[model samples]
Target: MLSHLNNFLPRQSSLLMKCNFSKMFCFQCEQTINGKGCTAKGKCGKTAEVSALQDLLIEQLKHLNSVVHHAKENDVKPVTTYSDHFNLEGLFATLTNVNFDEKRFQKYLHKGEKLIETYLKNGGEKLKSVLHENGIQTADFSYSKPLKELIKTGKEFQIDLTEEKRPVTFTKELIMYGLKGGAAYLDHARLLGYEDTSLYHYLSEALQKLSLPVSEFSLESLLEFALQTGNWNLSCMELLNRANTESYGHPEITTVSTTPVDGKCILVSGHDLRDLKLLLEQTDGMGINVYTHGEMLPGNSYPELKKYSHLKGNYGGAWQDQVTEFAKFPGPILMTTNCLVPPPKKYSKRVFTRSSVGYENLKHIEGDDFSELIKVAKKEKGFKNTKKLALKDIIVGFGMNQTLALADLIIDAVKEGAIKHFFLIGGCDGAEKERNYFEKLAEKTPKDTVILTLACGKYRFNKKDLGVIEFKGNKIPRVLDVGQCNDAYSAIQIALALANAFDTDVNSLPLSFAISWFEQKAVSILLTLLHLGIKNIFLGPALPAFIDPSVLDVLVKLFGIRPIGDVDEDLKLMLKN
Candidate 1:
């Protein structure tokens, strides 16, 4: 009788995939090593090959970093140093679901080939020669003797260079993923003509240091990187702010729709503002109406974007609901980033991905090319608008800059007890049922409080019939949609404004943060909040599976980062304590 190999296999394989780079370490992403990595492929379907390629990308980036640092110090000043090289749109492709094209990866592989010439122009030739000789390009990690470990474990607060392969841990990959999102966001802003050379430099340094082997540094040293990331994130947001304002105008306070218009329409989701602008331009007079979906809902608040004649109302609900909404809608959908849950088979062909968003067999729009959207819309016979009851019109454009300008009114509300509390009830939306905790908390909160929100989290209570309260002679409702989760940058601003007005530290203010997170973007925002020394923040519905027990302890101990409990209990806890 043939033996069942399955019986021989470990029911739950835990072995890390052998590193293709130096074979010195095993894959920490743990998704591709002969069923050893997580017992299944990763959520993004990253394989051992992709993991190795990613490491090589990091290795090349570090080589570039060494050159950039050396050249900057010695005044070598190469033409295409790490700053420009690292910011390629390729970084966006590496983010989960950003890109899945094998063809595209090959193109990037070629791009990686050219990167060495650029690095050579800068400062690290010795490293470049070793990189060339090392069979990393053809054979992934044949040199398992030692890995050129970047950010070594236990060294915590240090960035270093080494040829020793440090073991890759799950947390290390998670951190790398966060850095990738930040780097990608920073890159897009640079592409938009908004320049922050310092951020570009820091991003490269950060990316290079992510997995590098290092010696040691204190908590203070680790905080330095986190703060530096914060500083750069500030720079990124500023750059994005400038780019958005210049391209689409500063989002003015305006009401958007949960209801779709009755006629042919298109729903655009994700945060690619440039792609949105391109869509507006293309569909302007084409009889095809455009509607913002998910993060794209804020696009309607930007003045220039709103001016698009064909830009109609929003469609459906949060991204998690898109599988059903997009299926029912008789139109094409354009997704620019994550918040992409796989659409059902029926509506698959009608969707198009721009930038890093990809799904197998779906037509993905690339480059500055948004033409695919127009063609798909034509083929789909335009949208049969599915309209729902209109919710009360609520304002959206309270971005950090704009909200701070309204600090006086907000301050007055708190002083007069017009608003007893400020609840930062926002975060990424997911299909998980546990997310109902957000809405439950919202319902349970006092009527005298204000719901300050951003991102897809607003989908929970944005349509609720909360009566408007007269604060400062202006009748304002409890809820405010402050753009996307990245605009938690705005939430922080509003808090600082209230604190400054009240003359107390931000934590001392009667403000509570209850967030729902499902992805790395949310993870980065949480990290940003922690970096700011904010406390008593409640996260839900579950902490990331990647966070080890030790790391979770540190988070809870240092920041009081509690996971969401029962709504009644959490609300009472927040109110009483």
Candidate 2:
């Protein structure tokens, strides 16, 4: 209904104007369009109204941040209840395909309005006038009216990203996306009971800048904010790394079974370890075997999680393959977080969402109660018979603590030329054919080279038997799996340790990043790399649709960023560098 409604109305038609649909535009993710942006419905299947609502929620967060800052400046301690966490949730909800339900966004908008009202009411006239002068009128906080009123409010905040002078908009979007990614990481850490007041302060400051009127925003300011976003992202990554490690023991290189055992099962998807932990506890001794799916695959590496014998190995390849994979999955599937696609009718009733993940009608776990899911799993026809294994084993774990413990061996391998180079071929995997570039790059990176990968991108070549090499009598796997996407933080740690051991900067190390990006999390990780001054990174399958050529030119000049070319050519180029 969302996509067809937008399609039926022709651009510039009277009906479009009457419904206020002409202001709609979305280029937030890759695969939007080569020329025309996705103005009606996103290629990822989000509707114009959904996109507009996302923008409205972001705008509301900015306003809320502005108020928070104004109250601080006036020495008024604005009462805090949900403002901080809500700011993070609002941005994360906007991430591609994370939350498509309009009702969910409506609740977020209403909550943000209440936070703003609390700030305004407590601050009195002085606070109100301060925000008004900064271009946030009193009526801007009126997001509580109704969904229709909120939908109409989206028009004024529209930035018209399709404008010919796109570099400015592009840069703003890059920073915003990074912020979204940062918020997601923050939320994860916060869930694990980690808190940093200063990080929250910085987040509010960044959002406040984004709340500024379009006329006041400058290319230079946005670019500066983008770099600040990079710094903030680094902190976010550090926080999540700490949270994950403290919650679970530091990961050790552990081999995970790719072959499923015959039993009733629940395929747990997405990136939330806490959700997976709760399900594991609830399903223990209940006869429902649980397997990690997609990003959740890395859960096997954690000692706290792996102790549960039923928390079996990983199932699918990547998030993009879920529609088919979920359908084929015989048992109930629980999406713990994002990176979810709409399931097919055959499996829709059996699929459930928890935490931040939500769909129009998919069942969700409330208060971590997965009893119904366990019941369904017990009743459903699961993997009754084991099939021939396509991928028998996958080497996971290899977090910072684990990888760094082998520093001396790695250093020795480099000195003796047993390890010629290190390639961090990591990031989110997509359905795009060009993603095959990563597979070729990994396959061709000489046997002596150690390939360190994290996130779903590892699926590109993870199943292949890239024979191990012996270093100091150690059989080191050529392809090292470094946990989930958040584990990119661990990869960063390994790079730093390698740099420190060699008495040189990470830039001077024989390391390169050939990253495959699809969503905001990848953007945040890339920014973290830039913040650390690591250069000569190769990025593809097609650069983001939001980046203008001129802006990309700046990235190339400043960071030595290059697009991935022919597989062989890129391989040769990386080696030569």
Candidate 3:
């Protein structure tokens, strides 16, 4: 796919030469070009133009947020419905691998300018006075320049140039990344008609803070704000949890097939349940099998979704493997959210992006109308027959509600020594060889311990038959799939319930987090853990490149967060503790 992206290269190279800028500077994910940054084409296939445009979009959002913040402080509430949704969508579009279409960022940039105008117009005199009193001049949100000029302007706002102090810049990126993750959750909830004004308010406040000069805040103060971002992300995740469950019923323990059945089919990837539900509704009884990929695997566990017999089963693993898996998938594909890899030409025409997901050449579904997507599915040659595979099935759907239903059994087993410890061995998975640490650690976990897994990271060892733990004739699966990264709230609920049952704090319980992070959502989840004061988390394959050494030291001292070491040593330490 990247080799075919040469058409974008000449223009990108010209932009770099004219502006005297590096090709790009993005290190927003674990798989950046190097451990430092992507100074050429992005490892995720984002062109330099799109990368810079996204940076400009972020700066534009910060300026809009600053205006909204002052308007609210002056007792004027700007129309929130549009601004809130736009802010989230704008931020979400910038997440790694979410959107690579320069045109989409250009559209978002124009929309952001309009939103800022609306807020300023609604703010009137009182808001103007507040802005003047604070010496906070509003930014000119004009984005009418040519694409090349706009890309050059965007270079001025790159992460590296955001703050003079490295630690301050790094901390700011941390908060910004957390906001991006939180926005993803909030956006999902909003799509389901669940709205939290407080979460929206926090987003504006945080973005407003980011717009300020580094001299206005200390590293310690910024660090505190990062935790606050985490606290709000918890609330955002809670909102999404309610939206998903109340709308689709809490996920029940389900055994989903890894093989496909004979029929025309459509594969839905990414993390949006609402889009999946809509697609399912549209495809009912159409003889088209709807299979899930990546984080969408948990959709098979939803009562509303699984009821449809045509909703076949998952057909692929994590997002990282989509390049190979998607090509083999004999149907149209719908990417509804983040973690989208650029598709190769072989299946690029068969792929379509919906919601915030975008790739320049792929077709995009607008709104709830998946008619075009369904049409392509019907035209494509889907699986002629089910392929035989060693891993035929996997169990999922152990959400908070489902897990809580088995609370008595779990607690009794723990007391009876059938279960010794709980290991949270999941997060965002990547293509790095170091990620094998998660698989090895899971494989080595004692039978007396139960492993809770979620997100794409679970693809590391989810297929491995870890068997079950039996207590007084009651058998519990050794591994529990706790849904998507969006379902982290469910895992947190399980932990809180267990802590209450054991009469101890979560840190005191025999629970260890061996998190494998790849993107911004993982960063947000980490902040939530830190906000809860959860300690001794083992994070890998590598820490965020944006985290300055000094800022990392602060996190290490404050949160007891450490990098994953040898699997044997880490497992021994976790078990011994």
Candidate 4:
């Protein structure tokens, strides 16, 4: 089937990207509708087989979501933060780069567990019509499946190892990976007593429905789940935004260092703002410095986080660089969430996992055990001070409250020609060589441009000397580092504001969204962009796996989305458009 579409595939995608799905149709994850963009193989590592399975899995999840949504809406069990947390784990597992630790089957198992429980009460005979069964011998796999099995089956839903060919090159796989990050973040927020509305139910429902056998599910239904996956993730991040702001205060302009002081220290990374907060408390005046690493750089923006005297500096660039950077840092690292690549043996023992983040042998600090971290900090020497590395006291904690306060001024400045463009140059970061395109793109963006970035993607150029812009007496470079990947919502809001100010559509604004995607968070953000009808935004370094040729066509035709090319070319295109 892909052979026929080969004629339509981009010349660059002229590789062996075939996968068996149906007799007449072969899918390489999310290929372009007419085969113009989806490289024959999924940009994500999802195999041709896993590509097929994902469709089926999402089929199951949609069916499951229908029933679950109805139940929750009807006030059946009254889903809470806990349920949403677990839902995030499963929904995000199917996302690209996240949850690689668990098997794809584990995801199915988790979904199975929920389906069985829901089915037992609703009865297989009655709901079986609406709910497609996997045809397994187990009477109630979703109901009777053990906790371990839940995880195993859940991972199966994550991706099929048998058919999920390696060398994961498709964007779908990375999108899946990103979903896991979002899932983990959503899960953590739940653990800390945060709850989202329908997003949780939709996630569980999608996961549960994705298990349906081919004959039992419809393609339209599958597509619905995919979009719903994006929609729900948006909700999850919205909750995260609220939780982060209300809990840690909104992110403001602040400068953090990649260098740590020579003294006892704890390095915090991932998107868990709360964990970082707690660590800050635990290390307060305790002779331990808390160094932010990877995604944790945004933690410096929160007033609640900055108030910590020991919350010192950042270390390294992004998550992928950890293998090398962690080796040199003289402190214990606490990974609060996803993007945890295998640590080199030298520093593996020094790593710690809190909450749902776990590795096979990596010691995890669970329940409330800072004793291990404290002991290590006392034993090791952290950076004495960050005098040489200090970039200046950047104004950090700026949430919507702060941004909105400047709304009038920002609008006036735009009117006065001081601020010509608002560039959202952020997205997920990866180790891929193609990623350098973003660095170059950022370098070439106009000097008058105000950059709003978030996620690990910002790390690529955050350290660059972009210089300051004149904004209402403040001469700070317009490069604003918003918080984590999910915080893209802030960017969206800003766009909407500008649109309203100009009395025009969002696309009519002078702002350009140059996004770099690596995982599901990017996917969700992209979906939200489409949902809002934002168009011609540049996306890179690749496309997703699950986007079938037909679906990609729909995206391009309906939303005008495109993969980013050479930075110079892309910049010219953006400027012209």
Question: Which candidate wins on lDDT?
Answer: 3
Ranked by lDDT, the better of candidates 1 and 3 is 3
- Number of colliding residue pairs in model 2: 0
Task: For candidate 1, give the lDDT.
Answer: 0.63
Candidate 3 overall lDDT versus native? 0.87
Model 4: lDDT to the true structure: 0.62
- Write one digit per residue (lDDT tens) for candidate 4, span 1-577: 2232343345334333454323112222222333322323344333334443344444344545555644554445543444454455545445542333433434454554565465436544444433334333324333234444433343344333233332222323333443554565577667667865555555565444433334454444444445555565667667777777878776666666555565777888787787887788777878888888887777887888888878876767798788888887788888877667667689888888865454546777867657788788787766666566645333333345556667787788778888777788898887777789888888888877778787888878877777766877866466777667757767767678778888998888887888887655666677667656688877766665445455566566766767776678678777764
Models 1 onward score TM values of 0.81, 0.94, 0.94, 0.79
The alpha-carbon deviation from the true structure for residue 348 of candidate 4, after best TM-score superposition, in angstroms, is: 0.6
lDDT per residue (tens digit) for residues 443-479 in model 2: 8889999999999999999999999889778888898
C-alpha lDDT score of every prediction, in listed order? 0.63, 0.81, 0.87, 0.62
Flag regions of model 3 displaced more than 4 Å.
1-21, 124-141, 161-164, 387-391
Question: Across residues 134-196, which tens digit of lDDT does each residue of candidate 3 receive?
Answer: 776655436867778889988777554433477887788899999999999999999899998
Better TM-score candidate (1, 3): 3
460 in model 2: Cα distance from truth in Å? 0.6
Clashes of 3: 0
